[model samples]
Target: MNRKSRWAAGPYILWMIIFVIVPLVLIGVFAFTTDAPFDENSKRLTQEELAAIEEEYAETDEELPVTYKTVFTWDNILSVSQYLPVLFNSAWLALIATAICLIIGYPLAYFMSRFRASSQRLVQMLIMLPMWMNFLLRTYAWMTLLEKNGWINRIFGLIGVGPFEMINTQGAVVLGMVYNYLPFMILPLYSVMTKIENHTIEAAQDLGAGSIRVFTKVVIPLSMPGIASGITMVFVPAVSTFIISRMLGGGTNMLIGDLIDLQFLGNAYNPNLGAAISLVLMVFILLCMSITNQLDNGDEEMEGKML
Candidate 1:
């Protein structure tokens, strides 16, 4: 690159190193570090206790057990079983939410793409409008709307459905995820669909392909890149999001993010475990991105074949 371009990128690279790269490195280090909670009478060393030992290792007591020794032991790695359930649950929830978003968002995106410019602008405005307000506020608003005695329940009561529970359920968690991430799905798909060649669709129809055939064999294939992009955008954040899950799903819905939070701030007090979980989460997202990129490449190959 030219000198000016290199200079322009220098600040961003430095900032990234100072902020993102440094924090990630620290997290990885802490992941490997020993971290356990303090116990007044317990014979075992906690994570915090282990960290303290390393920090004060220079104090020199040949009698005291090695802090780094126990901290990086095989037993500690095996102890990650406690976090597995949460990780599994988080993955399951994210997959379900992504599938639901794909189903709903594809249709909306298609509609938005096919509509007139003025109408499309209005629809886009409606979709983007929710983002103007705080996301947490929107989740809280849904809580109020879905509570047993909330607006929906009151309407149901009039029809004799009476006291239907909505808040604090798995359904509530899914609802929050879909509500928050639907736009991510729609926007990508819409952008792809809007750029789709009108002539190709018409040509397919002219060649005796029905509407369904045209959609499935032509439009859908062309839109695969957008679909993959949307899924990655929605699924990654959904897996790591704790706020909506905590507020909507309540006690029953325990996700990986919640477990990570508890490790750092809650009862777990094992920042090592939190760091481990975060690293694992990053790996999962990397996998998702890899799959999406593969799909995008496949789409490009197919597009090349079509041309």
Candidate 2:
């Protein structure tokens, strides 16, 4: 709040302006610009040179005058409709992964929160252990396990069930998203759940509430912040994931992330389109966060009214 505090924040302000704000501005510029760069050489040509070239070419009709300046265009953004399938696939899969994480994570967090402090610490560490490894390496390990002759199939063989196709499927991609993002869901829930005092739940039960009623009416409403945070953490990355779908889904189940990658780096090689896709994805994520915030705010209001 003082001059010294303002000075301390200078570096962070400069860092955000340079890295975050500038890049977003550039992406916005690129998204609205034509893919082709303006050719300065064409502008530099003299009228005489142009006339000579036209005469040599001997066109049957008058050629339209062309400008050699970059112009804003909406084609890149509008073209996103062509990739609707990929976009839908990404949204649908990300939603499934987020739902799965919530369903599995809430109960896990609730159970873990009831443990002693020492045991809770151990459980938290165990939940976070897999995250210490590189994400790419972890996804690759899943690929190895899901492949035709992978460990899963070997286990199935021992059970006389033989191998079933697992890798290169939509289910595999969703599984990878859930596996990687589950901890994001669990940690937030666990943190919030641990902060809930036992007295609150006891009071709810004393009021003749059943276990489900206590959880729904007391525990869940209190933990809405964590639920919102976890959903955002899990859903955003799952929606934008390219590597998991590429490696585990074998490139067959292309998501919006893959479409964006292809535009910038793959055969498509269109940065303008990539920027457009990125902008749309950013808007979608912001919308999701906004909805989550509304839900969290509603829960807080309801909790206040109850109190």
Candidate 3:
């Protein structure tokens, strides 16, 4: 890039430094440090000091406020073991949702990619139409459809199946995640699949490869970039989601996101612990992305060798 291109990136660099870099530094600082001890206005009192202060204040009919000195501690991160189940649940659910999205999305993308350009555009619009609505609203819409007396049950009732409990369950949370993030999986896969030339598949068929073999050996390997990108895009948000689990899982299925929210905003009110959880979650997401990148690289290398 030239000097002008570097200059054009100056605003983006400043924005990232101010918003991303600074906030991460602050979270790191808070995660490592606790309150400082013994300020001029707030001092830690010993038992004897407390007794003396109490005795002196007893005459005055006023009580002194107690304050503890802040210090660095590892308890916040160490205690994360207690919330290990929540982390596991988050990872498990996100994985399940990502897998479901991939299973459904790959076929859909493949089918859509074979359509004419105009038809593909129309289908793409339909796939993306739901996303134009607010995410909260879309999740709420699922709540209405999945609730016991919701539309799904009502339709099932006509078939003599009566209502079944659907909302406020792990399945509902997964449904919500899949519903919201499926587009993320589909669009990337479609973008990559559409770029594949028809002549490549034709050449494979000319070599006596069956439809299934051609798809497995040719189309999928070529679309690995989209697959990796979609997995990362879907899994990261699904793992960190709090609102879907809260609204759909009925607060019973507390994922890591809920735990972090509780630490910062709920009765827990511990920002240090929240920061620790956030840091761990960030590491998990980075690890997932790293694995995806490795898989993508491996696929590229294999493809190169085949060529």
Candidate 4:
């Protein structure tokens, strides 16, 4: 707000311009532009050719050509039909993964926050240690572990049990998502739970409230912000995830991320349609973020009221 603050913030402003603003502008431009002609030999317009085209357009144009449109024609929209299944599958799998993450991660985080201090540091280190390993290697490791005749089934065979199938299932997709994102859910929830003041719990007990009542009235309410953040962190990536789904699921599970990848790399060469699907996915991500923000701000307002 002041000159001193402006001076301090100048570097951050410049960094945002270079990193955040520039990438967004590029994505925005690409989202509007039609896919380029792949058949063209040179794969790029020459400077002189570009200048001639610009001159032709500028010289006799009755009205300016439409640069972009918010709403695309039905034909253009229909072109994105190939990605519908992928989009729906992504949404479903991510929702399931988010639920699983909360179910498992919440209890683990609560225990670590409540009982373990020195152990908590060690566990946190172990969780983050996976980051040191290559991500694709970790994912491939899951593939090995979950394949029909993989380690678990081999062990089962030794005990006279039949082979089991795990890989290439929806379950594997969820498992991969949960494994990759559990730490994200845990850390935020742990931070919030650990920061909770003990006096509030004591006050609830002093008023003869039971443990469940105290948790419901105090703990859950106080931890809402952390829970909201965890959901966002897990949900967004899980929904857009191609890496885990493609590796674990193979061709069986078609996720939105896989569709985008296919458009870019596989048989489908429709970049414009891919961009359309991407724009839709971006809208969905924004919707999730907006919901999280509202819940976060609402919790803050409620806390102020309590104070």
Candidate 5:
């Protein structure tokens, strides 16, 4: 690479080092280390009692007596088993939402790609309009709409269908995820579909292939990159989201993100466990993306072999 190109990449490399690498290093540090009381008596106290004692010490100016020993331990990582259920549930919901987004977005994307330039722009604008608003506000709107006495139930009442319990449920969480991330799926697929050669699809039709065959064999194969990208884009955020599950799922549907937040930022003062949870979540997300990438590559390999 030339000097100009190297210089251009310098800021990006610096940014990664400062933000990404530094945070990962901090998480590892916190995950693996814990403060053990140097005083034997302090170690014997319950966490609550210990906190009370610490508070008492803090209120007085006298150089708080005992120091804590920074000990390395596997307790934090081992404790993750207790949270496995929440983690698994988060993964399941994320997969459901991602699959729904793919099912809905693919058809919309294909149709959008077939439209004229002006019509295409209008559709793109509509798809992206929701995203221009605050994420929290969008979720709040859904929350209001799903309430028992909300506009949706009122409309249902008019139809004589009666009100239904829509808010604070697993279905609500999945709905929020799909609503928020559907555009991610559609845009990528649309971008890829627009680049697909009209001649290739025509060639399939010219061979005695029907519409279904042309779609399943030709168009779908060409759209694999978009499928992979969309899945990654939707799945990662959906799995880690606490707000959607908290607001829509009424905090009953606890996710990995919620657990981590509780440990770190909530009343619980356990950064160690939070960091470990964060590390595990990062691993799971990477594994998911890797599997997706492998599938995409396998598709490419199969296509190449056929060629």
Candidate 6:
């Protein structure tokens, strides 16, 4: 409302429009349109043009189609239908990773929230220490450790157990995702849980709430916003990741991100197809965020009604 506020917000608003809105518009244009291709044998070309082309390329058999004009079509989007299985695999893997994060993070977050200030700082630093390493390098370290003769297999060898294949599997991909994104889940839950006062929890206990009852009815309900935030944060990146799947799954587990990457930068070399896949991914992420937002709002409304 104030001029000072407007001035401060102007650059951020401009940045969003230039970066986000323009890119989405360009992707949509690419997804919905293509260069109208014509060949000498095609009926769209005139007979005279066909004769002229035959005379021109008589010495060689290399037939090059010419771009006639740009036309709008649904072919690019429709082409994505065949890749739905890849997309679904990405979603399923992401869901598994997110659920694992929540299971491991919820208790860790609660315990961290209950810590003394110094201890909380120490524990938080420990959680964040792994993230200081490069993402690619962290993944590489996992690769080294998960190899056939790696440390894990050696440990199993000492116990008279055979070394099982660990790397280049779906399990490896899921492990990478959980290891990398687990912190994203923990920090948000910790941030929200730390705000819940001890007196409120004690009051629930005073009213005959057992440990499980207090956690389910009071703590979990209050932490719904953080749960939603954590899911969105973890799921979005996990679903779109190509490097983890490629490296850990040995390129066999191609997710939608790998499919899009191949179309743009691999032997596929089709920017139009890549853009269409990116558009679909963007829509998927938005729908996820929308659902999370709805959950957050519903939780708020329920709390308001209770009060």
Q: Which candidate number has the best lDDT?
A: 5
Worst 10 residues of 4 by lDDT: 64-73
TM-scores of the candidates in the order shown: 0.84, 0.88, 0.89, 0.79, 0.90, 0.90
**Ordered list by lDDT, greatest first:** 5, 6, 3, 2, 1, 4
lDDT of each: 0.85, 0.90, 0.91, 0.80, 0.92, 0.91
**Predicted structure 6: lDDT:** 0.91
Q: How many residue pairs clash in model 1?
A: 3
RMSD to the native, candidate 1? 5.6
How well does candidate 5 score on lDDT at residue 100?
A: 100
Of the pair 1 and 2, which is ahead by TM-score? 2
Runs of candidate 6 exceeding 4 Å displacement: 1-16, 38-65
Query: Which residue ranges in model 3 land beyond 4 Å of their true spot?
Result: 1-12, 36-69
Q: After best superposition, candidate 1 residue 220: deviation in angstroms?
A: 0.3
For candidate 3, lDDT tens digit of each residue in 86-202?
Answer: 899999999999999999999999999999999999999999999899999999999999989999999999999979999999999999999999999999999999999999999
The regions of model 4 sitting more than 4 angstroms off are 1-19, 35-78, 304-307
Better of 1 and 3 by TM-score: 3
Tens-digit lDDT string for candidate 4 (26-73): 555555665332212433444466556567779774543323223323
Clash count for candidate 2 is: 0
Consecutive 10-residue window with the lowest summed lDDT within model 6? 37-46
What does candidate 5's lDDT look like per residue over 227-252, in tens digits?
99999999999999999999999989
Poorest stretch of ten by lDDT in candidate 5 = 37-46
Candidate 5 global CA lDDT score: 0.92
Between prediction 3 and prediction 4, the one with superior lDDT is 3
- lDDT winner between 1 and 3, please give it: 3
Model 6 Cα displacement at 13 (Å)? 5.1
